[model samples]
Target: MLSGQSFMMFVVLLCTCAFAFLNGFRDASNSIAVAVRNRALTPTYAVLVAAFFTFVGTMASTSFGVYLVSAVELGVPDGIPGLALLLSGLLAGGAWGLFCWWRGLPISSTHALIAALAGASGASALLGNDGVHDAWRMLAGGVLLPLLFTPLFAFAASWVLVIPVTWLVRHSTASDVNGVSRAGQAVAACAVALGNGLQDGQRTGAMLTLALVTAGAAQPGAIMLGPQLLGAGCLAAGVLFGGWRIAHTLAYRLVNIDPLRGMVAQTVSAAMLFFGAMLIHLPISTTQAVTSSIVGAGTNQRFESVTWQQVNKVLRNWLATPLVCALLGGILYLAMHPLVS
Candidate 1:
């Protein structure tokens, strides 16, 4: 007969899957917020579109993105031996994401996943080296990029983008400019959704796969297509549902963004995320990217127009994101450790 201890470990893995579902529910705010708020699409339709892309992206990539994020970095081994770490990670990430959502503070699922992975792996390293180097690499890819470049680059990139469109209006014929701008807005918004799907969806896939590994159902080296599908499906559905409150904040409150400015910021942020997902295999936060992009574009409009208070609020939450996740994960593990063991 299977050992009782083994069965408990399986329960831990199930919890990890539960966390993946929460990630979908909590982070759904990121993709559809802009589309729904802009009146480009109804909230329901926006979420549907977002959900479809998230599902496609998460399901398509097997071993990449979320799986690697959830599994390899936290020192979780390929097989069933890694349950504690995996469950700890999912718990950490879910708590962090939920906290942010409750506060109506937009933090990146990318950031949450990275921090949770670190906490799990860091704690696990106390036992022995399973696979923490990947965590360090992830630190570079996920956190470092957002911290170093997102605000600066996103800000600058948005301005650079806006300059051309503004200039085109000035230099080109004015007769059809409004129609052209409107058309451009539609295209840009859809592109942002696509880009976010390519980037963020992969993280969902990674997390789902990690859940399977926690249960000993798969190896880190092996790909679980089922988990990927579930992750993608949840993420996309969440996006389709959309977070109306946060969307309102991002669309109107963060900065005084008109349609053209919003388009540039969204597109630039999406591009950064897409490139990171494809090339760096790094998970970047669309929340940070878009916010920074908006700040960037806003700064160009007038230094005074950019809302420093809003940015600070976001920064404070950014600082809080990892701390909360780590603390919660450790506590949850301690409380459940004996039961799991």
Candidate 2:
């Protein structure tokens, strides 16, 4: 928007937009691990298989509720500028995500983006009360809540469920239960695939919905079918690309995952994500959901096995995200305002 031809703007969009794709690759491990690690599917072929299914599911879905995500909340003011808002916040958030990827750290794109949106919106809010209440409530209720809860729910579900299931596995260890576990793998795999569709795919859909509005290709306030389908397709394609570097960190390092743990985590993440998505047509963070699930699963293995250090790191990022984004948004909005005006 700068001088109506800032190459930097386009460049930033290209780089920042990839966060959605990276998000899927990074989180795919939650679903693929049980199948791949357990030899239910070879890594290469398994991801390919997951990729194909994920893509299909996303493309097939409609975008009826896309509005929930295209807009973020923070008690922002009206004069902040939408172009500046989208550009600066996304750049900061996207850069944050890429920075973590470079360090081989698995962080949440949701946290980064939400922080960016909140920061930028709050900066604008200082100007007037145009979009304040709508945004902040959303940040707290829609985006932040799900991301925070994914792990909490995952942790609690696994905490209560894993012990009993583990005991059962031990009990059934005698009579060729391996065969039964193997048999159960197919069904579990399907559930994981559905989880991917509802979980990761929705975030992509939301962003795409916003992009279309920003570009004047669509209307605002409500999400539509086209953007949703497009977003889902893009996300599924991302999963096929594979994010092995960090996926291994999650699946292997998080805990000694077996089929039951993997499936349960996937199922929990999917349940929460899908419900959130359908509730407001907003794309919630699968990264948060699945990460929480893994963390929860880790606790089920014993709190000692749970990586509190990593959890602390994640929490720190979550806490700092908004402040950093707010500062970035304020600075960039001021700088870009005159040019756009």
Candidate 3:
């Protein structure tokens, strides 16, 4: 016998977990694409390593959860309406993720989620006396800016980092360089998985927490272990099971990645993502970061070596996904508002 609020909250929590699972499934390539492409690790082992590190990262910290909760609150005030907004956003994001995964496109689930949330918040505001302008402003300032800039930073950073690494290793024997690169690839893969788990897991955790608070099932400050574990576990399973399609696109279609290039690209992307998520408190897209870093790393060999067509497709998807999800989110929120309100 659950109360109406409690039932709705439970639904929202479930949706949040589902969204996280999709995030893991779609972005698993972000962590292991280079390693797989370079044959540094077998696909099975690479996924296992990614899953293990993802779980570890999720359990390691709650800081990202806190930041995401605060950001959502800033855009959509907490209550029943806020819960509705969150649910709408999660649905929109998840739908877009599934579509992209099916199409073997490595779009950013992070951008989808952020854009959906913004759209839902705008719709929620519309139902009330407050206009949608403030919500849009908050989203633009807090989430959109970081999402837009972090990939560029990762691209530039990876390009710069690869040049020096290339010079340093130029004199080494091919065998020696290969050995070092294989080892580095493993390490960088772990870091990327860990960073993804922390950033994405925390987002799901924050959504669950918000739902609980809205339902009066928990206080604002109370952190629940159950939701955290559920989110992390689901994400790990998603990584294990549903990553192959996007993995192929990323590993084979983007660029011909050698062990050295893979190592450099993964290392740069992981470092940038960790810095953005932990220090800058931004929910940057690991997918976009890694993709851009791959481009940067490929540029070291020659611009012609990179598949510009595939890169163009990815870039187009990245720009379109958010806008499409935002529109869908707004429509869903508007439709659900009367019932929820």
Error of model 3, residue 171, in angstroms: 1.8
Better of 1 and 2 by TM-score: 1
- Tens-place lDDT per residue, model 1, 1-341, is 76654664656646655655555555555555554555556666666666665666565555344323655655565433356655666677777777667767777766666666666666655545463457766666677556667767788888888888788678666446645654555565556666666666665666566656655666765446676666666666566556656666676667776556666777787788777666767666777787788777766774577667877898888877776665665565555455544
lDDT winner: 3
Candidate 1: segments with Cα more than 4 A from true spot: 1-18, 62-67, 70-74, 77-81, 125-137, 171-178, 219-222
Query: How displaced is residue 303 in candidate 3, in Å?
Result: 6.3
Determine which window of 10 residues in candidate 3 has minimal summed lDDT.
65-74
lDDT string, candidate 2, 8-114, tens digits: 33433454446656666665665576557655567787677676767665654444343344534232222225546766666777677666656556666666666
- Order the numbered candidates by lDDT, best leading: 3, 1, 2
TM-score between candidate 1 and the true structure: 0.85
Give RMSD to native, each candidate: 3.3, 4.1, 2.2
Q: Which candidate do you rate higher for TM-score, 1 or 3? A: 3
CA lDDT of 103 in candidate 1?
Answer: 68
lDDT of 2: 0.60
- Sliding window of 10 residues with minimal summed lDDT for model 2: 71-80
Give RMSD (Å) of candidate 3 vs. truth: 2.2
What local distance difference test score does each model get? 0.63, 0.60, 0.79
Cα lDDT for residue 323, candidate 3: 85
